[model samples]
Target chain A: MPGLEDLYREIILDHYRNPRNRGELESPPALRAEGFNPLCGDEVVIYLAMGGDVITDLKIAGQGCSISQSSASMMSAAVKGKTLAQARSTIRAFRAMMSLHGQALDGHGDGASGGGGTGAVGPEEDERTGAEVAAAEGVSLGDLEALQGVVKFPVRIKCATLSWHTLAQALDEAEKGAGPD
Target chain B: MALNDFGPPLDVARIKKDFPILDRVVHGKRLVYLDSASSAQKPLPVLDAMQRYYETTHANVHRGVYQIAQEATELYEGARAKVAAFIGAAAPAEVVFTKNATEAVNLVAYTWGRANLGTTDAMVTSEIEHHANFVPWLQLHQEKGTELRFLPLGEDGTLDLDQLDQLLDGAKLLAVTAASNVLGTLPPVRLLADAAHAAGALVLVDGAQYVPHLPTDVREMGADFVAFTGHKMLGPTGIGALWGRRELLESMPPFLTGGEMIRDVRLDGFTTNDVPWKFEAGTPPIAEAVGLGAAVDYLNGLGMSAVRAHEQALTAYAMRALKERYGDDISIHGPPPGSERAGIVSFAYKDVHAHDLSQVLDQAGVCVRAGHHCAKPLMRRLGVTATARASFSVYNDEADVDVLVDAIGQADALFG
Candidate 1:
């Protein structure tokens, strides 16, 4: 079984302590979308500045747990300069990583990052985690790979996915030329 | 885990054995279930009663013409009688079966609320009500133009009844919860009902959290309508009761009209059935009612007073234990010491979100609910987005509370 170290990687904690793009955008040029996870009252309001097909800038405004808050922090950093299609694929791949099939160990990623609490399934687990990280948007998930442990806890998947869903909504609103209403 | 630490004189181990789920392991640890406020674990008697009902007696009631059908009808009505007696209702005819407490509230809102309350009339409720009770009244007020009044919740998690009379002005109905699922605060339903009566308003008590934990007598409460669910009281799902005054139920039109809720059906129109059946439409939850009857029998056997005392000891120990262990790192939300409360402990940890706390706790096999608890208005009033809740049941003892404390400490360390 993967230890608790997998879920609480230092990179995830660093992101939680210092989130990127944490604020609101003006409503005129940017579209705002609000997302809610009723399970734990984790809410996110994503403000997007879209210049044609690219997301020029974004801000994260909400309060939640480490998985949610840090995920929002990493999400804002990852999608700031990506095109609309890339962001959508990242959301789908992140959802795939969070999906549970068989009972598996809980961990963030491989031993290469820093932690040394790997057990019997170290290589196989890291390889699988690496595959998930590599597959998300065809780019290294970096800090986002720390959330691989979330699949072991089904109830917290909503926390890890709230920000991405909200970003998707913001993109939807940005395309429609309407407010987040 | 060796000895019962919740208190003396109660058979805590034997009671734990009655619930089959307690013996199961979760995530390689003994399941320390503290989410009873969401739904209590059912015992063997309730499960057996349901299975027996299906195996021996399964038929459409009130219209069959066989020995087994009569036996099924007898068992169904017998369950209703048991429910009526369990809550001290005036008669068996006064109890109406619905899907759950939420449905019971909807029945009153649609049948009584829409027909009588409008314009100058108002429906007064409190901020502490579950959405099951709050949303229906809010919808009525919006659709019918009725004024809506809400009693405020104090900082200490109790209702501010100082201005209750003033809030009741022009209100035709006062619907409120008997207990808070989040704060575990037990409001004075009898007092509230008396004041609402003096202001010429009928009272509807949402007993979803009360009937399962406390000794309930609707007449003693002086509320005209009492709603509660069976699953919260160790019965199966799909069964709940709405006990209204016979006269009040008679005056209101049937909420649902169908096979069982009607007396006779003609070409153009149909006459409704009797008081209880008038509210019950189509095939009711017969097997679930049997399970509820067995649950009532089980509670009666254990004695409601004993059950209440056991939970009181457990909750008090939990509150003191968490505070003594964590000090200011944790804040338990509820009434002050010496005040009567249910076994629910809603708490918040310093600088940690409820979702995170719940996630870390689940790693150690501690089950708790982390969210608004379906009471968003009250959550807003409390000024917190959400709270982590640990609710006790008859099967829980101090061991469970100890496990919660250790798990929370682990979570605190991880966050630090």
Candidate 2:
């Protein structure tokens, strides 16, 4: 009950139903990145338009479960119109949340935070990338907090984080003057 | 499902008692495990076999002359014999052990595929394969330029065998799954084998899903290679077998070269060991093999026909119950009820993504796999990204089906 209530929040379902910034951006001028949750075959492709330090525009495209699609939808909204540094901070915070070793990062201090994430059994715990994402440069997870419920279901965390991780990889690639292939 | 209802008198409660994990509680309710297509729950006999082997006969096999070592060697080879007999193989020598069915496929991909197949020759497989059969061919096609062809799948999840001959033209091998893990569709293996033989091509059956549920006779199936895993058949993980024709195996080169697989190693070159051992390089899974033998014994005791009958009834029950309950809200894939199929039932509930559906199910202690079920190309073919799969085993009863139906209703209510 602790994790499920938050996991499938109404807002998250709404985002999944009608994702924001959904689609592909034209290439070259707009760099593209891709991510996949091999466990569920959830794929997320993000296109970034970087104008100076700010993200001018971004678009997300792929098929996946509610946590992933909604997370991508929420992620696209969170990063768009934000500076590259702020977006990068949010990625770090998200990864921290999904990290395996418990209490590694502050869990944004919600009421459910006291007894959050019962943790899925066996060999899969290591696969949970951001178990309890603690911090970011005050990027404020905001709508992304709906995904905090994914912590209890360790495997689904990968689904929730695919786009953000892909965005991080894209940003890193952008710095190297190479777009994600 | 109330134990007194109309169903098979298969002593499911006793069967469930065999698996220790069946008693586990998830989310404060009895765990109704429905992910047997992914992996089956090992029974106490299998567990005890491995435990006993580790405690008593723990030694490096094939190297030592000591008592415990001999016992260990006997156990490891004994598993091969048991597995061969279970699948109705000609000889134990035909069974080559690997890590899992995936590794078994890789073994063939590296050894047989690399040696015999090339650019000019083609390989035909189905889209319904669990990447084990699909990816290797794709890799062969890409890296070695082997012409790759797929057996077109029907909308009902059966193979479109009409294209078999055209696809098998000039093909050296036809790889296919005996049963689709996702859709629960049982392909006509013997028929496909005949088609492949007509085209002068060898057939490899990925029996990972089939061998566990069905009465598998490799010779009767008429396939050259039958690959399956121990874990999926109620044994421990890290043990799978590739039952190949002795002539083909002897002809093929070794996939993994090392200690046990070789007869003699010189500075210049090395001579390989016997057929199965030649393929099984290094130290094999000793205790795991013993466990596999016990699992085989367990299956033999149950009788494969009875096991198949029980699961078929359960599958048919699930189909009728789900349709009766959800109607058009749920769409079950695979051949309709009464058609030849196995235990797996993969379905989609309207717009509720499989992950979300499974999550709600999980809350009610119903365990099911929610994804492409490792057949992504098939998933694409079916026009869905993911599906919730409920697979049955020998232990599952009408009670389990009742729990699953209730859980689905809960998910539907939540999403609604």
**TM-scores for chain A, candidates in order?**
0.75, 0.75
DockQ of 1: 0.38
- True contacts recovered per prediction: 0.62, 0.65
- Model 2 chain A poorest 10 in a row by lDDT: A104-113
Write down the DockQ of candidate 2.
0.47
- Tens digits of per-residue lDDT for model 1 on B1-416? 22233224468899998999988887788999999999999999999988998999999898889988898899899999999999999999999999999999999999999899987788799999999999998898889888989888877788889899899987899999999998999998999999999999999999999998888899999999999999999999999999999999999999988888899899999999888999899999999998999999998888777788888879999999999999999998879534358889999888788877887888788999999999998887888889999999999999999999988877756677
Q: Which candidate wins on DockQ?
A: 2
Cα lDDT for residue B378, candidate 1: 85
Candidate 1 docking quality: incorrect, acceptable, medium or high: acceptable
Local accuracy of candidate 1 as per-residue lDDT tens digits, A1-181: 1246777777777888888999999986788888777666778888999887789999999888888889999888877898877776565555557652221212222111222221123333333343564474485565677888876666566777778767766776666763445
Chain B TM-score for the candidates in order? 0.97, 0.97
Q: Each candidate: what lDDT?
A: 0.83, 0.84
